[model samples]
Target: MGRIGKTAAAALLVLALSACTGGTPDPASSPGPTAAPPATGAAPAAATDPAGQVSGEAVSLETGTDVGNGRPASSHDGLMVRRRMVIAVHPTPDADLGALRRQLDRVAAERGVLLSDISPDVLDPVVLEHVVPEVIVALPPEGTHEEADALAGLAFGPVGSFTGVEHVHVGSVLVHDLQFRIGSADPAALAETIASEGILSDALGNYSTSLDGGALTVGYTGPLLSDELVEAVREGMARGAGVGPGEVELAPRSATGEGVDLSAEPEPAETEGAHASGRDDSGH
Candidate 1:
């Protein structure tokens, strides 16, 4: 299968498994026309404009640094296995979308980057009033640092006549298949444990968790995925399931372009216990 098709198939498989296990449905699974909210959290009350649109400057996320202009810093390099760029554009209420799309197309073509998807901001209802637009672009894989840098430059750099660029994020796509062998444990409880631990929260990055049978698949895109972060997640899942940390297994795979593979067999997670005391050695 082609790249996009492969990615889609992998995602569908995960969804199908999630459905069988009675996991929460992904928003994408919902049918019919629906508006998409903001990619990040709610805009600060102080940052809202008269029209109820959050100012672009106020949407702060830890995913990518805000470099002046439309360009964000290069977030893909040797250390990163995969990367994707989410560019949130805040246009005027009456701005011409056709012209903006054309401008985006031109930029993508010029930079040789794939313009993956574009959608309206529906995550935040307030932002919907402003009709913010978000663009998703795929970056080069590992070993193509130069191409990744060029793409970042084009994205964050100036675009003709298109302004009000909110936030630009470039980060890794971290995918993991979590295996829990605990007997009769509730998936909901496990999910709540992971969420409450703040490992999958927006502060960590944009992430999703789906349960299929006894396995939980998590996908996140933002910043870097450190061993410490992964360990924390494992520990939380174990604690949530009422099992030892060693009982939970995590198999992780990262991608920079498109699609995710969640079918791969998971490996036993590292048992070194980076944060066994609920605190890093550095103490935050």
Candidate 2:
């Protein structure tokens, strides 16, 4: 019996060893579960282009109304072209303020423009707001007719803000950088010839200048300026000479002649007074 018991014990011991050694797995040999699938659809990183701003569309002046002769103007999308001019006027030889006023009066009568001679100190901010001229010709500096035309181009911006004004037109004419590129014989032809030689580099940008007998025609590459403003400037130029619309020309910075010179006109009386008072023309 002792032998039988011993034998049975030995068998049981063998079975225990087999179960421990053969049935259990080797963890090192077993493959691990796959990592969670890579996170899906990660967003792309932001990038920037070297050149911003797509090419801007050209503004068309042909579609709007004419505001020539102060007939009223129109509005436009922000894309409207705005031109501005500033001129300086100097006192005529004697430093006479009254003569300045008289000159302005005469100019106003002939050009149908309003003129006001406010005291230099009295030209307060409020009055300035009310008296925002399309062209602010500073007296005591003087300017020329060409300068006036450039100012006329810039005046379009101010007039564009007026209600009932449609399209684009020049608001004021500055007499700065005013050069008389006047031609003889056929006024229009002369104007055209001069414009052909100098308009691109002198007048507005990319605008073409032409002549039709005595009439001067100006065209831009893109669209017309403010209907009112452009017409105003054209008519203002035409008042002395004939001005009209021409073809649209393309080519940047094509206009020449450096800018206008408003100082070409006579200066105001206050200018001399300011200069005499040791204030230089700047203070008055």
Candidate 3:
């Protein structure tokens, strides 16, 4: 009613990872509807928040199993205190690739949120099958569930206006990611610490960081990332010489950072080609 449910949002991550065609998306294309599988009481109840928008009940699922070996990782295996989610956008006919990217970039930057723009490329076959996305904003994790939801909602609040790139409501999927503010630490140095301490591995950990100005911007990774692995990395950063509680702060950007021009026709800015803030999933 209000928006898609949280569970459905998480479900979309699984759908995207599995349904990816690894080919470039056709902006004018759309996926044909799949008949909704019959619902059963046995099936999990529909996700309440930002969910139920999807037509059918999801009966079966697959995850970090065939992708790798060893104990399987469960998406709901833990509480999502830290979080990441994907916002899929269905563009209006007038929407151009660059316009969509700028719309999301300006809006997200205004909120100090980093974005990964999967435009003219990714097509989440399972959920947003009606319209091709001009941009999909990958929101990084906020330290707490309430915080994460608040940030996500705020970033997505200006969906169909402001910049004038209207995105018809499609679907938003919450992916797996655990993030912490690693204040003032050199990302490269902390990365080395994570490596030396064995915080990351092909098995379960991750080593991803981003920079804004000269400081390490909060990094995000998930769905495939392990909680234990991410936990170790957070600890490594927080335990540093003067680090304290590693929490997330959804603050706006400083004055030095470029501001978004909300007027429909904004003057040109730097190239966000396919990623906002010159950052992407790799934590550039």
Error of model 3, residue 237, in angstroms:
21
For model 3, residues 1-284, the per-residue Cα lDDT tens digits are: 11112222222223222111111223333321121112221322221123324323221211110011121133323333122344544445564757655655665566567776422112232233333455565555332222223333332332222243333222223233333555554766765665565543332233355655445544434433333444544555566424653542322222222222122212222212323221111100
Off by over 4 Å in 1: 1-80, 83-159, 163-184, 197-199, 254-284
RMSD of 3: 17.1
Quote the positional error of residue 80 for candidate 1 in Å: 7.9
Better of 2 and 3 by TM-score: 3
Which 10 successive residues of model 2 have the least lDDT summed? 13-22
What is candidate 2's CA lDDT for residue 38?
Answer: 22
Instruction: Report the alpha-carbon TM-score of model 2 versus the true structure.
Output: 0.18
Q: For model 3, what is the alpha-carbon lDDT of residue 193?
A: 63
Candidate 1 lDDT (Cα, whole model)? Answer: 0.35
Model 3 TM-score on a 0 to 1 scale: 0.32
TM-scores, all models, native as reference:
0.35, 0.18, 0.32
lDDT, candidate 2, equals 0.26
